[model samples]
Target: MMSKLLKNRYLILRRIVQITILALYFGANAYGWKVLVGNLSYSKFLQAIPLADPFTVLQMLAAGAVVGVDVLVGAVVIAVFYGLIGGRAFCSWVCPINMVTDLANWLRRKLKIDRDARRINISRRFRYWALGTLLVVSFVVGAAAYEFVNPIGFFVRGLLFSIGFGWTLILAIFLFDLLILKHGWCGYICPVGATYSLIGSKSLIRVEHNHLNCTNCGNCKEVCPEKQVLNPVIYRKSGFINGIECTNCGRCIEVCNDNALKFSIRSFLKNN
Candidate 1:
C-alpha cells in the first residue's frame, strides 16, 4: 500500500488540488467563504486579487465586450503564472473535467480496452483550429460562445448550483474519451487548453529527460497523456520535453522505473 501510494503520489496530489479548488468554489457559493470566490473562468482571490482565465478574456474581447481593468489584470496574472510554470497545468491540476476524463482513461487501461483499440484519427492540432473557430464565433455572435457549453463550467457550476444539462455533458465527455478516442476532449477540442498551451510554450519548469538513465522500458510513454511530447527527447537525446502540450503533470516521472525522466528548470541560455 505504501509503495502504491508513493508511486501514485503525483496523481494523488492532483486529485487533492482539483477537489480542493472545487470545494473552495462550492464553499464560496454556499457558505460565503471568500478565500477563493467565483468560477474558473473568472475568480477573485481573497476577494481582492483577481484571477481570470486569459482565454475567456480573449473571447470577451472578440465579442467586443468592455472588459474591466480588474479582469484584464487578472488575466495577465494568470498568463504570467502559467507562462513561468506550465500552461496546461490548469488542465491536469485544476480543471474539474480532468477528473472525469482521467477516470475514463484509467478504466480503459484496467479493462485492457486500449490494447489493440482502433482509435479515431483526430489530429491534436484540431485544438488550435477549435480555438480559432471559437474566437470567430465569439466575434460574430457577440458573446463568449464556448462559455455556454464548456464542460468545465458545467462540471463546476453544476456541482455548485442545480443539476441540468451539465451532468449530461460531463457524462458525454467521459464516454467520448473512453470509447470514442484516447485523450480526446482536452487534447483535440478544448480551446481553453489550446490557449494555455500557447501561453506556456516557453515555460521555465519542464520535464527533463536524461537518456543515459533510460532503459527503454516504455513505461513513461505508456502512462503519459501526451505521449507525442516524449518522442523527441526519450531515447533520442538528453534534453527538455519542450512540447507546448505537455501538462507537466509528472505522470511520466512517477511511472518511470529508471529515473530517466524528472522535472527541472528549463535552460533558456541554450537552444533547448
Candidate 2:
C-alpha cells in the first residue's frame, strides 16, 4: 500500500513537472517573462544554465588569487540543495531534460523496444570517455558542444521553432528513444548528469536498502532506470545507498513491496 502511494505520488510529481516545463517554455518565449526575472539575454541564460559555455566559473577557478566568492557561494548552494538531495532528483523531477527523456522512454515502451542504451555490452568506461570529450571541447573551443545534445535545448527548440520543424525534431527524439537507446541521451550523453553525479557524491540525502526486509526479488533492479541499484558494489552496502549514479527518482523505493527501502540523510558534523 505504501509503495503504491509513493508510485502515485511520483506519477503526480512527474506530470506536474512536465506541465511546468511546457508552460515555462511557452511563457518565456511568448511573454518574455524570463527577461523580467534577471534582464538576462536568451543566449546568456542558455550559457549560464545549460551550456556552461564561456567557462566563466572555470576561468574564475583558474584565477586562484581573486576568486568570485559570490559566484562560488551561489554555485555551492545550488549544488548542495539540488545535487545532494538524492542524486539527480533535480534532474529526474525538475530538469526540462528529464521531461523529454520521460517522453522518449514512454515512446520506446509503447514500441516494445529497449529504451535504455546502457544495456548494451559497452564498457562502463565509455561514460568517462564521453565526459572527457565534452569537457575538453567546452574548454578549448569555447563552445557548448554538449548543448546540442541536451534534451532541454531540444525541447526549447521544439517549442520555439516552426511547428513543422519543432514537431519533426521531437518526433526524431521519440523515434530514437524507441528504436536506438534507453536513456541514450540522458545516461551517457548528458553532461549535466555527469556534473551532477560528481557533486552529488557527497550528498547527505540518499537511498537506504533494508537487507533484512529485502527479499532480493529484483523488482528494484528491474525497474531501475539507471541500473545503479543492481551493481554488486551498491548491493553490498549497508543501510543507505551512496552510489553517485543514483538519481533519487525513488522508483526503487516506490516499487519495493516489502517496504525495504527509504530515503535518509547523514550529518557531516556530530553534535557536541
Candidate 3:
C-alpha cells in the first residue's frame, strides 16, 4: 500500500488540486466563501487578486469585446504564471473536465478497451488548427464561440451553478475518450489546451529523462497521455521532455520504476 501510494503520488496530488479547486468554487457559490470566487475563465483570488484565463481573454479580444483592465491583469497574471510553470497544467490540474475524461480513460484500461478497440489516428496538430479556427470563428461570430460548447466551462459552471445539459456534454467527452479516441478532447481538440501549450512552451519545470537509467519496460509510455514527447528521451536520448503538448502531469515519472524520468527545471543555456 505504501509502495502503491508512493508510485501514484503525482496522480493523487493532481486529484487533490483538482478537487480542492472545485470545492472552493462550490463553497464560494453555495456558502458565499471568498477564498476563490468566480469561474475558471475569470476569478478573484481571495476577493482581492484577479485571476483570469488568458485563452478566454483572447477569445474576447478576437470577438472585439472591450476587456476590462482588471481582467487583462488577471489574464496576464495567469499567462505569466503558466508561462513559467507548465501551461497545460491547467488541463490536468484545474479543469473539472479532466476528472470525467480521466475516469473514462481508467475505464478504457480496466475494460481492455484500448486493446480490443480500433484506434483512431488523429494528428495531435489538429488541436493547434482548432485553436486557430476558434479565434477565426470568434472574430466572425462577434462572440467567444467556443465558450458556448466548452466542456470545462460547462462542467465547472454546472457543478457550481446549474446542471442544464452540461452533464450530457461531459458524458459525450467521456464516451469520446473511452470509445472513439484516447485522450481525444484534451489531446486532439481542445483549443484551450492548445493555447496553454503555446504559452508554456518554454516553461521552466519539465520532466527530464536519464536514458542510462531506463529499462525500456515501456511503463512510462503506456501511462503518458502525450507519449510522443517521450520518444526522443525514453530510449533514445537524455534531455527534458520539451514538447509543448506535454501537460507535465508527471504520470511518466510516477510510473517509472527505473528512475529514468523525473521533474527538473529546464536549462535555458542547454538545448533541450
TM-score of each: 0.97, 0.72, 0.97
- Ranking the candidates on lDDT from highest down gives 1, 3, 2
Report the lDDT tens digits of candidate 3 across residue range 10-125. 89999999999999999999999999999999999988899998888998999999989999999999999889877568888888888888899888888889887897888999
lDDT of 2 by residue, 1-272 (tens): 97566576765676687666566656666787462122111222332442121223443343333544545555555566655455566567656656666777766666657534445554434565676676666566565455544455556566655444445555665565556767666666555666667767667777777777887777788656678544643345446666677777777777778878877785544210
Give the Cα-based TM-score of candidate 1 against the true structure: 0.97
Backbone clashes for every candidate come to 0, 4, 0
Q: After superposition, how far is residue 237 of candidate 3 from its true place, in Å?
A: 1.2
Off by over 4 Å in 2: 1-6, 21-25, 32-76, 106-119, 160-170, 233-237, 269-272
Mark the regions of model 3 whose C-alpha exceeds 4 Å error after superposition: none
TM-score of 2: 0.72
- Worst lDDT 10-window in candidate 2: 35-44
Give residue 256's error in model 1 in angstroms. Answer: 0.4
Q: Ten consecutive residues with minimal summed lDDT in candidate 1?
A: 263-272
Ranking by TM-score: 3, 1, 2
- Residue 68 Cα positional deviation in candidate 2, in Å, after optimal superposition: 10
